[model samples]
Target: MNNPTSGTPAPDGTAKPLQERCDNLMKRIDLLITIVDRGKGDKIVQALRDSRVTYNLSSVGYGASGLALVDMLGLTSTEKDIIISVVPEERASEILNILLYKFDLDKPDKGIAFILPISGVSGPIALKYISGLQQARP
Candidate 1:
């Protein structure tokens, strides 16, 4: 009997190993973090949604730097909106470009956005959810 959990068969008629498929999927996952001025979290989250990101979290944060130089340079703000998002690695660059150009994150005090490699996830269920594969399954 064909196992549903097994990887799909290749052109040569041999099934690709499930572990290999899972590893590939995991490798394609990445974390995107964007820090913006207070009250801008919604815009950032909306951008992620428009980019097809399925999962994201946002929270308020305060700049911890107390250096006089930072204050003098107008480089710090007391209130910040931190947004954490899950995105496919292949689309990470494209999304970042959107944030950079559209949001002006490259300009000082506008905001900062970056991508981090996700080494692992809790389990397949979580992985599928983050990867948006769960929605593909009926």
Candidate 2:
């Protein structure tokens, strides 16, 4: 019989599935977006999963309604989420877009998000763990 993936090995030979064994290392970034109906920054942190959050002067609202809404009182009370996770670049864009539309990000500053490059990754074996995690998740 013939081999589809070179199905059989050679004399005293070792045949392994051909996967790229490259030394080229890479980093990935994950983005997360959260939205709340005003005055709920504290609730945002409560809703997070697997994150150690530290916000920096994050504020949102229109006018004195600020954080509340004009039709409403006290700060409009609206907020958004922009989360970041660094992984392999191969998976970065996937996660970015996942948050973009998943969180209705196209509608102006309803929310903002982006990703950046990272350096000094260990190696592929270390990176493969992330891939394994993905499989285990869903």
Root-mean-square deviation of every model: 6.3, 10.7
Clashes of each: 0, 16
TM-score quality measure for candidate 2: 0.40
Give a tens-digit lDDT track for model 1, residues 17-131: 7776655455468899998889999998898888778798999998655688888888767799999998878889998999898898877678888999997798766887886
In model 2, the worst 10-residue window by lDDT is 18-27
Model 2 lDDT per residue over 29-109, tens place: 233334433554344444332232222233454323233345365434344433333434565566556556554667754
Model 2: runs farther than 4 Å from truth?
1-19, 23-82, 123-125, 131-138
Question: Residue 69 lDDT in model 2?
Answer: 47
Worst 10 residues of 1 by lDDT: 1-10
Q: What TM-score, over all chains together, does every model reach?
A: 0.73, 0.40
Clashes of 1: 0
